[model samples]
Target: MATPGGVEVIGTDPAEAQTVKLLSNLLWFGQVVAVTEAMLLGRATGIEPTRLQELLAARSGSSRLLERDYGTVLRGDYMGAFGIDRVVEQLATVREMAAELSVPFELSSLVARVHEDALATYGPVAGEMLAAKLLEERSGGALALERLHEE
Candidate 1:
């Protein structure tokens, strides 16, 4: 049987697949935070955020998540495809799972806390990427870019 735009896994049980899904969400949250911090540092250090986005896009640092968020972040659009509250929830689950399994979750715990702070700061409905504002507020600099929406 053929799956449409999906992968077929052999011999992996439901519990393992659930783990994979949770880990994927955790990774995505980590990606948003990591790329936001990197680009925020660039802007704080006297670089244009858009240019930083361009350089990163061209360089080995580029990834799909980075490319996807660069424009939204630079433009300060908190339009939620996903919300900070939801990411925090997922991270919380991942954190609990880590504790139950005796896994080192220091980084995950930190990221989850960061998102919790972000949710508190930005409101529960704010976009997941709204956490970028946390960096801007901390740095006292703007991450604004001229938004270019292709019609």
Candidate 2:
């Protein structure tokens, strides 16, 4: 079946599927950090309220699009069948990205801790899915940042 962006879904091997999930999650998290940084920059720069409103609207639209994409992914087992090792790998990537970005170390550590706990409590499939969803949302937020930069 065609996914939201008109992309065809393919059956993925367990290992490859896990990698995709991890990469997707990493990209999504990066997007979130980028958007958050942009928002804070805009606020600090004292951008006019009207302009801020426009940016926010654009961000919201992008978020919806990401949500649709993520839903399509979840409907397939491509990532769902991944093992715990894959989830750990994905988390490590996220943590590394967060560190490189200088994303408040404290916050990053907290998020990592929480993610570890979630994975432990829920098992790999559920944990990975949740992480994937968050990443998807972040990707949308990143699109919003691109829009704002263009404007």
Candidate 3:
């Protein structure tokens, strides 16, 4: 398929590939938001065990969904299915926003550390790409999550 800027890439349809990449980026951003929110909530309200469990369950469910989608895209052999650099850039943006908004340092630090580890292990680009892919799969359809909870 023809990539933008005349860059040729192999594997899945270019549109599909781009969609996967976009989804992955969204997922990563969501994860950062969710984690930061949860941390702030815990600090402010003192999360009960049951609430924590619910949160954990939700996080796990989301992660699983993203993993499934990422795997599918990878198995489809999409070359540009992931974009790590974009992820890092987005993360930096998130950090800046949090600082400007006066978000707690602890939460921001945690996010930074997590991203740092991810970058170290997966390399900046690959790590973000993989993370985004996994997150996208986990998010899935909203109905799917509701049904999962019912089951």
Candidate 4:
């Protein structure tokens, strides 16, 4: 892939590639949980959630996932191009694999629970972004971008 004008593609052995995929997906699942908490915390402090996302994007808190999903969540756009059930299933599978490997995977466990809770609350039909609904419940407010400008 590197032959394609500086588009680099690093190859890993199968085991490492699977490990990388597991960890990468785990990070994605965990991030939604973390960002949901961060938004709720920011709201609790009277800062608009969208403003917090902007501030984070300009600071060390930024990440491609955070910047992208932050808007999706704040806009109340749960149009999960991907299914929540699949994500939750994957998270559960990873956590189970970790356990069977006798590896400590506390964060994976937490992420699984968070996603599971979202599914329980919103049902299987809801978007994977239902993670934000947990925040909405906690903050007693909708996680919508329009609310940010009013503040």
Candidate 5:
């Protein structure tokens, strides 16, 4: 990741480096929307979300995001590592970047909408995974551990 100048330089171009960071955040936001939706879908279909989450984690669908965060989700604790409002903002930037490049951005747009909904529902300060809470609420069940329900 070192630039041509020296090992201390992260990138040769500042704009390109910023774009890389933005795209990485955008991908993470997309993954959150997707993983949460899958959990909700499994719950709606009579499968325990925890079990389904385990299956996804163990199989080809596994992602670093899912592996690291899904357990926190099951515990009813959406990590406050990032805010829903920040997620929405990042997605919007990605959408604008895509439009400028004349690239098809349907998936990015959808992901943005999901984060927007979460932001609207939970406000700016809520954690990134509040989107999962929104989906769970819409499904009339939660993706929480049984002990979380007891508490």
Candidate 6:
């Protein structure tokens, strides 16, 4: 079957396939944190949040998730397509999997905590960008995007 982004076979076994799926989700979750932090930093340094978002999207630092979620983030829609609670659950699953493999996952553990904190603050409402919202809130409204006027 064809999809927007060509799909690659991960593994033959269902367990392995599921592992890959969880890993992919974990990567996206991490990217959300990174991109949001970068945007917040840009704001702190006096760059407009929207302009910084554009630069990041165009620059080498861009990721598929960042590009895909751009509009949603700008509009503050956040998890309009998914639940923050689900994100926390997935991160927890990935962390558990890593633990079972005896792998050291300090960074992943931190990423999981970011989402856990978001889930705690937002109560599992829709908006994958809740972590971003959390950061913006922490920054005292520094990362809030100016309203984009439609032409």
**Which numbered prediction scores highest in TM-score against the true structure?**
6
Model 6 clash pairs? 78-127, 79-127, 79-128
How well is each residue in 1-151 modelled by candidate 4, as lDDT tens digits?
3245774444655566566666787887787778888878887888977788888888887777677766887887865786778778888878888889999997778778878988877778648777777767767777686754454
Worst 10 residues of 5 by lDDT: 1-10
**How well does candidate 4 match the true structure in TM-score terms?**
0.81
Q: Which candidate number has the best lDDT?
A: 5
Better of 2 and 3 by lDDT: 2
Clashes of 1: 0
Candidate 1 lDDT over 25-121, as tens digits, reads 7887877778878887776787877888888888887877767756777776755888788888888999989999999999878778778889998
**Per-residue lDDT over 20-77 for candidate 2, one digit per residue giving the tens place of the 0 to 100 score:** 6655655554433333344445545766423553566467535532433333332322
Candidate 6 stretches with Cα past 4 Å from truth are 1-8, 146-151
Q: Which stretches of candidate 2 lie over 4 Å from their true place?
A: 1-12, 48-53, 56-89, 93-151
Assess each prediction's global lDDT (C-alpha) against the native: 0.76, 0.47, 0.46, 0.76, 0.81, 0.79
Assess the local accuracy of residue 89 in candidate 2 as a C-alpha lDDT between 0 and 100. 60
Return the TM-score for each candidate structure. 0.82, 0.35, 0.35, 0.81, 0.86, 0.86
Question: Once model 6 is optimally superposed onto the true structure by TM-score, how far is the C-alpha of residue 135 displaced, in angstroms?
Answer: 0.9
Clashing pairs counted in every model: 0, 0, 6, 0, 0, 3
Model 2 residue 94 CA deviation in Å: 6.5
RMSD of 6: 3.5
Q: After superposition, which runs of candidate 5 have C-alpha atoms over 4 Å from their true positions?
A: 1-10, 147-151
Question: Model 5 compared with the native: what TM-score?
Answer: 0.86
Q: Clash pairs of candidate 1?
A: none
lDDT of 3 by residue, 1-65 (tens): 34577855645666665545544554554554454344335434655423443466567445643
lDDT of 2 at 20: 65
Candidate 5: residue 50 lDDT (0-100)? 75
